[model samples]
Target: MERREFLAALPAAAVGLSLTETAKAQTEAEPFPGFQPPGVDRWERSDVEAGDRPVGASFGTRSEVFGRSGAAGTSHPLATLAGIDILRKGGSAVDAAIAINACLGFLEPTACGIGGDGYAMLWDPKAAKVVGISGSGRSPRSLTLEAVRSRLRNGFIPPYGALPVSVPGTVDMWWTLHGKYGKLKWAELFEPAIAYAEGGVPVPAVVAYYIRRGMTNFARPGMGIEELDNARATFAPGGETPGVGEIFRNPDLARTYRMIAEGGRDAFYEGDIARAIDAYFKRIGGWLSYADLAAHQSKWTQPYSTDYRGVRVHAIGENTQGLATLQMLNILEHFDLKGAGFQSPLSIHLQAEAKRLAYEDRARYYADPDLVDVPADWLVSKAYAAQRAKLIRPDRINDKIRPGDAPSRGDTTYFSVADRDGMMVSMIQSNFRGMGSGLVADGLGFMFQDRGQLFTTVDGHPNIYAPGKRPFQTIIPGFATKGDQPWLSFGVMGGDMQPQGQAQIIINRTDYGLDAQAAGDSPRWHHEGSSQAMGEDDPTLGPRGLLRLETGVPDRTAAALAAMGWKIGESDGGFGRYQCVERRMDGNERVYGASSEMRADGLALAY
Candidate 1:
């Protein structure tokens, strides 16, 4: 069939077409100028880290673990160990996760703490399906859009300060998760974290780096912060972020956790903690109040999914950008990526283009479902993706692509936990943008999330700021099932990188036949300059954005992409940090494999 004829025959919403490899190859747009060498990959070099690998290891690989009872993959080794300890004590995955998350507050507080919002996806063996929850908080009841608009200095919410602070939801989410899926007492879960908080643990390299960076940014002028004394006194007490291996303690946090342990979730939301937060914000002239904290509630959400190569990928729906992953997967499902080869120029181009296309819709549709009527069903449907996929020309980038009448917009910590009984959890929590708003409530020991900064100030946008509204969130956790069985629990941490990085994980495992560790270990590509759903007017973003490749990607691929109208650049470690746990039945026993990102101070352990 001719190029036009091939596309014509495919139905607008059909899926699982058995297109041949040769036919798929023909779909590639003729290379721009047809002269750039297909840039070859630099897979191995003696000067770099690798020396030897296990028989089944993938590139830049580490030892992936397998276990029959349980596994935990966390950004911090200490946090991972805490989770394992919880599992050993007969805790469920949710229980282990609560423990791990609590530990991360002290160990990796630059990314997560109780003051942040949280989102999660889980596989409940008893229910035999995936479950999801949205722990995002509402803007203060008294803070109107006019109030927010009057406060914007740069015509957008700044990354740090009380202006962007929202009533945190992580504490409530923890109780919710525990109430539904936990097998251990809630107070017991915080025991490990509380002890560690009081005793002090040595700061790791990655957290230390973010601390220095976050403290510097928080201290910068014009960040909308009325006070920096609290933050400086809380985190950088010595006038700087703690150095790696330096012992760090948060006795304030310890006392706070102790209160939560005794008072339940109410301790944070309805009790003394909330009062303290309310008082601090009032003192600082911020919006949040005790009424806002007391009124906060996080809801359970039905996760959205897409079929990709026989696996069902699941993520939290709107109010978050998670659905964009499903949409991207839907578009890429049309191509014979397996034939193009893993990490090849053609494959990378296809992924990048798919991201650009889906994100256009992201800028148009994703919003709080309670307030906006997002066509969630149509957005991720195979039909919508099939129609959208046709816009791409094999050789050229589609700069004119716009939203298909659709819409959305952190830094975050993502972790995975699985227990012996088959329950699995994918959890991501964050304070947003380098250690959150620069306000730490008196004696509470955690910074309020800067997530409100993600709300676009564009007039009449669905995601515009409003009292009692949830801002468009940046963190998402994901789960996947294969052949109706719990398959994978995974997530990637970084604002905007979560969805794309996750899509690549599925593609790597299914299309490229990579094992769990290698799927995460392989070099990745990240795209920059997507439309910010800002209703236009902002000048920096262009029609087609820049494509950034990791160090291991070949120059040939970059050359090929540039020839095809892509502007290529190198990465600044923003690709994302991934963690995952995969389950498979080996003969009669169920076994699990865990993988953690090499880019962060993370670890994957099984037992």
Candidate 2:
């Protein structure tokens, strides 16, 4: 009998079973001998094979919430719920964040996964200080500038394929954070994600959209199905992407998580998983090795901060663009953004000019700290910002700005978590570009990050490609403190939009007195690349500068920016998705405030 005929013949009640139960029942029945379900693990059946479907359609508008116990916010409602569940189980904020991020790896694969890198900022209430975790992986020892240039077409590595793959650092970071601040057993944190992976989650609307987009790209001519077999097998089984309400499962990922839970980090870094990854890289002509995986370690670094209007802004130092956000905020501190009015021409221009100056320095100086001297303290110094602020003209845009002498400074999904005890966690993770390098380890069910592509091929450049050197990263986690107490934990997920979003959120909250939710919901603008010099076309920026403003920005604001020589374009989706949790004093008691982005299919939940 045909598959459709078999399905049609089933009883309505059988059909009504949640997708997970239906699959298990069919497998148990063994209707056809030797038949195996798509994406099922051969070794063992998942323990939790069925559960209730996710509730409600995303309304795209979430209210700012206040909670006395705890608050959690993320780019996905399910992930947020998972974090809250952890907190309810008497886990710390770090434990909740780890659980939340693990779920995101399974649910939002387009933005992040176990194969990517991560950075986090955690406020330890006992220690009374914010600690930074750098989970970024280094380049393969065999991958060198000469080797990369020999394969490059125009001094730029292709965005996809094995060439751009980097060693994954997320798993290491997870274990490191958990070992220090986690209140629950490491295995316990993986339970929620494992259950979701096995029970089959309903595809979220945003995830379905990105999955379809990826399928379309992979189906194009010359991009054979065999090249991304693992991806197709996991995300597009049956040669079709799942729709928003359809159930999707990855038993392989569930198994992988279980192994890591049992064997700790060694299962992923030095055991069968690592060996399989090494073999896969060899087959694909990639440079990663088992030694690199075994040698990879996560670092606990002191977070760097800058004072902006009495609020101390903390960001991960080195190899990340977090410092750039601080610099931008410093420059904007010299101006009265609130008095200029939200989205006003003067405000927009000043923000854009500051970003341009910050990015110029970022492109020049930000890189792996272990490999180069990153002048982090000098970059975030108020005096240096004052010097860069002088380059911004109130009357017109300045296109001649260059990297300052002070030196610098780095896409991705972000989620923020805060527990009732006032401990906060701000975390960001990514694969550098959408869907990452598109290289899934054979049967591992995850994509390797394309972060290495960000390294410059130029000799002597701060971000120059080198063996065992980490590339400059775009994903950053933002944290803010007031009077040495945890005040805010937030992050924005998008390539260069991260720092830009960070600066805007701070300005909106501090200068305009907007609540966390309102601050994230406000319309925003992004300045893409630098302007061309006269008739010369910048190889990096093409011909002209492009300014993208969301629809919320008034037409007059765009016109005013355009009149000042910026090529303005309207953007449908605003700058990026933002998630934030702020701790505020409600009289004598401290309360938590949480906010989720309006442009995303997520919610801010409190309990």
**Which 10 consecutive residues of model 1 have the lowest summed lDDT?**
38-47
In the range 1-607, model 2's lDDT, one tens digit per residue, is 6978878876655677888888777777664344556544232322322233343212224457889889999988999999999999999999999999999989888789988999999888989999899999988988877888887745676567777678899999999999888899999999999999899989877888887876677667754223687878988989898888899998888889999999999999999899999999888788988998999999888989999999999988769888889999999999988889877999989898898888777887788889789888888899999999998899887867888875334347899999978789999998777787777887888778888878777777878788888888888999999999989999988888888999998998898777788788778898777531211113565323678997667789889988988888658453888999999898988888899987777888988
Q: Name the top lDDT candidate.
A: 1
Off by over 4 Å in 1: 1-49, 406-409, 532-539
Q: What are the root-mean-square deviations of the candidates from the true structure over C-alphas?
A: 11.9, 13.1
**Cα-based TM-score, every candidate:** 0.90, 0.87
Question: TM-score of the candidate numbered 2?
Answer: 0.87
lDDT of 1 at 361: 79
Runs of candidate 2 with Cα error greater than 4 angstroms are 1-62, 221-226, 407-410, 531-544, 572-574
Error of 2 at 110 (Å): 0.9
Cα error of candidate 2 at position 487, Å = 0.7
Against the unseen true structure, what C-alpha lDDT does each candidate score? 0.85, 0.83
| Worst ten in a row by lDDT for model 2 | 530-539
lDDT of 1 at 87: 98
lDDT of 2 at 103: 94
